[model samples]
Target: MTKSAAPSTEYPGLFSPHQEPLPGALDGELLYSWCARFHRLSGNSKASTTSQMLFGHATTGLRHDFPGQLGYFGAATGGHLGTLQEIVQARTQFALHALFLDESTRRATESVFQGNDRSQLSRTLGLSRSGQVSLTPLKACPACIGEDRGTVLTGWWRMDHQWPSMYACLKHRCLLNVMANQGRAHWLQEWYLPVELREDQWAEHTEMGQSQVERLIHIARWTEALLHQRDIYFDATLLRHVYLYQAKARGWMTWDGALRFATLRAAFADSHRGLEALPGWEFIKEVGSVNGGFLGLLLRKHPGRRHPLKHVLLMAFLYEEPLDFYAQYENSKLILETEGPAALDRRLTDMQSRLIEMVESEGKSANASCLELGIPTTQGLRLLTRKNVAVHRRPRILTDALKAELEALLRAGTERDEIARRLKLRKAYVKDYLATQPELRNAWEQAAKVQLAARYRAHFLRVLEDNPDVPIKRIRRIGGNGFEWLYRNDREWLAENLPGIWRRPET
Candidate 1:
């Protein structure tokens, strides 16, 4: 049978403010190995060295020296080595001391050095005479290390102070300065040091009494690690204020006090994984005073401790904090949850109604109307009215009176040529119109042939009726077939009946 571990004991108050201890430091070899591992994980070239891995450089002549020591090179002041790593290590060491030691020991150790000349002791370590000394252990930072080692460095430095301080170094100084200036360092000294320190038996600089320095270093390292972790998840510049506020609040407040209540509430957001399960403002009220402001109002009215105001307020602040990402995420979620199928259905229904209306307005026979509506006639028919709509317009035909006139002339034995001359219309027009009519279609079709034969007989009779001055042969020669045909059919008859007179040529 497998054995299960016992549940851990809980603190009496879930909402009580607690000082969480920093994680333990890895061994020196492990740290070096981790640096190498970090380089490998980052996909850097295998030719890189540990210093290059840590400092972002690959120089062959880089130097290493003890913390807070300075070196000189050809009239130039240089010292310090592994500035970033050392500062980070110092912070970790301070945080660890704070975690393991009691407040009195921490305080007593902090009080040992009154002035800020941390580098005064560097002379004993064989550093350059022209180089300045930094009194504060935190000032024994990475740049200080690099300066002592005669190597170039990168990152933050105070221009007026003439010392390059890494971000980690500055943070440590800031935290301590906030405590010291605010008169709260004693609070930490009182709460975190061991009980034996209460008797004043502890000697300064002894390993037993190094807890305070250890705490400072541990806090620095832990803070650095926390910063690194946060950088992985968020933009560092944006969250810098948050970390600063937390540090200030923690240092200034009485043990487990209301200092960070608002900040804590703001940090707990639903979007932050696993935070929904944690008691936020209720936890704050349990440990802090009820008269503190909006949080206090919540605690007073909602004593049930289940009101969602805390969570709501937290989410609101977080959404406000990172305006870009939060707003985009919120908008995307709303569009996804509310718009998909319903919006599509509404659009489709509108299209169908428009199609129906268009077809009904333009009838099926009107192809131009279908073109105007951007739909093919076949598809448009589907949308038209179900009833078979009829069109009344048809092709025009010749009238009955016109057809009868042509038929009477055709039956009269009067020559077709004479009839055409009397009508004064084109022969083809009369023939075509007569042929198109069903009643006279056949008669008109054969009329042209019969008309030519009648013209020949008429021409011979007309020539006998009217004798001309010219011989028949010359007249036939001058007129040829066309004039002879006209003369025989109608011209000769007109000349014989009428008085002799010259006529103009037909145009």
Candidate 2:
């Protein structure tokens, strides 16, 4: 239950001849929330009256995130709520969204917020397709309501609590309580506060595991940190460099700037596990390959406005802290400023050439070459491919020593294709050799089938282990080729190892 505050009785008309005192905004309170509070206190029968008086139009301040026409509101209030820029930075999510935008878009968005013809604000910032207040229910923190009661007279909606990325409150560390109504117009005409809502008006809280709760808190904190950073803005190109740099450190990208997307997806899936519970993060649940989803759009060389929340989510996953991400960005900016991108490209080309030399000339395995050069095996392989050097295929003709090695690997239960790769023989060559040696083929097939079944079984079980709550049917789609292989070859083992199918209860 929310604590209640008595409406003020002094100063009758808010915008009339009497000129009643307007309510001051609470710290971190939303601009729409401040106006709603005023409407309630002013005893205005129509919401339009308060809207017209404050923002010179009925719908100007209706949008919660980017309430346009701040100039009118600032003038109407006689500059009581501080400057227009001050109110926008302090009350709205402008600063948070600006952090991920380029300088031109950031300025355009800021201008829209302060200008008269401001209908293009959301589209300018790429928030027209967002899953924010328009799509979700109004959210309030129960713990925050109780805390706000002590500081202010009534419980008000918090700007940070309303973020699409924020499933939990940063200070409370608990899930936000959502209003029952999910419509965008839930508060359009009404002037009400969180304290005035009935018990039945709130939605049932979604239960989450302790780990999920902690993950939500971590993301919420990062969002709030970005929200408060009014002056900082990131360039899209610099951000891409920062991400690529970090990816290299984690062996998710090559020295020549080619991304090992499969490796990256697997690692990102692990890092981003359980974060899809928050709204707008549904895309993260289904990991996409290269050039697919938000990950692809963000890494690409473009001037598009990727959502700030997504940027923060990636930042949180890549770096230990926001400061660490900022430090990396600063490093990239410094490199670009001093050395320039051409020098960086040259340095990468030199590194790739060195890696090729180590693998092709020195006869070192790609993995061994990478380890010696302090890089990842994937990087070495990609670098070798970039140089058109096929170290594995150089000795194509099956020599006596190569045949012996391939046969030894086959007898040890290695898959034929893998044997082909390891010995630099073509896959077709391995297949043709198996066709002639019938008895050797039978033994190798039996051993390889068993090995493959076990390997895929482990992979399928690991997917289940990572996402225990996902339905088995959905798991089959996302669990990779292993699920299909297991279902076809070893149904009995898969059935025994897999958890029971998940189903929703009937209403």
Candidate 3:
């Protein structure tokens, strides 16, 4: 039988507030690209119509780096794109700047994006204060566009190409093409894709020395990696320590934190002097003369201002890659915390000896030893487990009735903290107890998934009911978390309940 389509009446009316038919994100696709695709597919006549449907404003999608109203977008699409956290980490440039922001500022950025502050995000990230507004045009890779033509309708904007100082395409190892003569509003306010650009609008690529080209490419690759990495975070103090560690190793600074500024400055300037010709790269020419410059500001005891592009340039100059620098930063942290590697080794030895003496020589129980040492029982037990020493003690009694009750609670989807509170038990103790009961753990896990699936299913249906203008093709897109969860854990139910594309109800 031929497949039936959703009814014409069920189609979302023109300029519907609900944004449906949003595409699944392509690899490394920018949030801007995702929205642009929505505008094209929705057949909306004006850019503001798509923006209003997706972001509740005409200009929200215009901001590339810190796209506000993310919470609304997540809710509007019923979260099929991703949760707010997923959207922020995977689609936005937040991580690129997050490496340099303090913890509080980072948290604030999260709040702004995930909530309805509607404030200018650049100011919050200190971009305005640092005079770091991005003036460069949108960038694209010729090779990427060629490859994209085979799969997608148009080449989407990439997250990595939007970096302010990125001049090379990391994946293609070639110079990126700029959208020549197109004002910011032309691209940001319109649904212009890479494939839509006319031949004359394409700018000629600038020539650079091979060494300069390599340096720019190195910085571009580093920026790309930073954009995708979710786990790395560095603040002022940690960044300073890591920079000093490298400086000390290279004899560019004294062991006591004093830098030979003249020696370092000359070398840094020379390392990047050839890059001055590249558009937006003129900053390198004044590296030696810019007041206090980046070297002094970055390495100072307290840095007042930070620009992410400069940090990328400096980090690229210092380390082979971001992950390698992270490893060195970890070592620097250890040295800072323990005074030195020798001291760190001695401290570890002492800790091991104390754990041994408390558990073995002193004849103390694991709980007792850990309590006396002011450490967690889990830690103490781990040490004893490695030594093949059983922790002998009076076990906290788990009666049959209590065990049944605990299992029931777990299966009921009670949160761990709430369960602990009602049962008059410590949260960690309950956690450890759960770890020992695999059968019960498995049952609880299954129950949790079932409960979550039911919840998401209800939410997904409710969203559809509230936004009847949404088309059936768009229905799956708006299911967000509910759609994602049900799709993964209960595919049969999802397939069964998902409305027929051609079966929309009459109004």
Judged by lDDT, which candidate is best?
2
lDDT of 1 at 183: 34
Residue-level error in angstroms, candidate 3, position 402: 74
lDDT of 3 by residue, 1-507 (tens): 101122222224533324346578886788888888877888878888777666656777665666777766665666667777678877777777777776787777877785444335767777675555554566799998899898886789887787777888856778888767465556556766787788877777776778877778878767765654455566666677677666655557642345676777787887787776665566666667745477778877676557777777777887764656777767767776768544433332245567668788888666655544334566667777898876685457877987788878997877665666566455677788779988877877787777767777887778677777766544543313244345556778867777452375432
Error of 2 at 341 (Å): 2.4
Better of 1 and 2 by lDDT: 2
- Computed on alpha carbons, the lDDT of every model, listed in order, comes to 0.31, 0.68, 0.68
Candidate 1 lDDT tens digits, 1-507: 101111112222211112222122222212222232333334445433423322223321121112111111100111122223343233222222222224554343333221122353232222233232211121223333344344212211121111111112432332121011113232111111111122232222222224333333333333322222221222222222233223332332222122454554343321232222211222333323335433443333232221222322322333322223333434433543588534322321233344454444544332333333333444444444444333322123436865567578765544444554554333445556556676655554466546654665455445534545544433333311233334434565446653332332211
List, in order, the clash count of every candidate structure.
Answer: 55, 0, 13
Task: Judge candidate 3 at residue 44 and give its lDDT.
Answer: 79
Prediction 1 TM-score vs. true: 0.15
State model 1's lDDT.
0.31
Give the Å error, residue 332, model 3: 1.7
Per-residue CA lDDT of model 2 for 299-384, tens digit only, reads 76673666776787777667655656767777777888899976544433356767788777887766545555545455567767
Model 3: lDDT equals 0.68
Which portions of model 2 show Cα errors greater than 4 Å?
Answer: 1-18, 102-104, 115-119, 128-137, 185-187, 254-256, 270-277, 289-291, 343-350, 354-373, 376-507
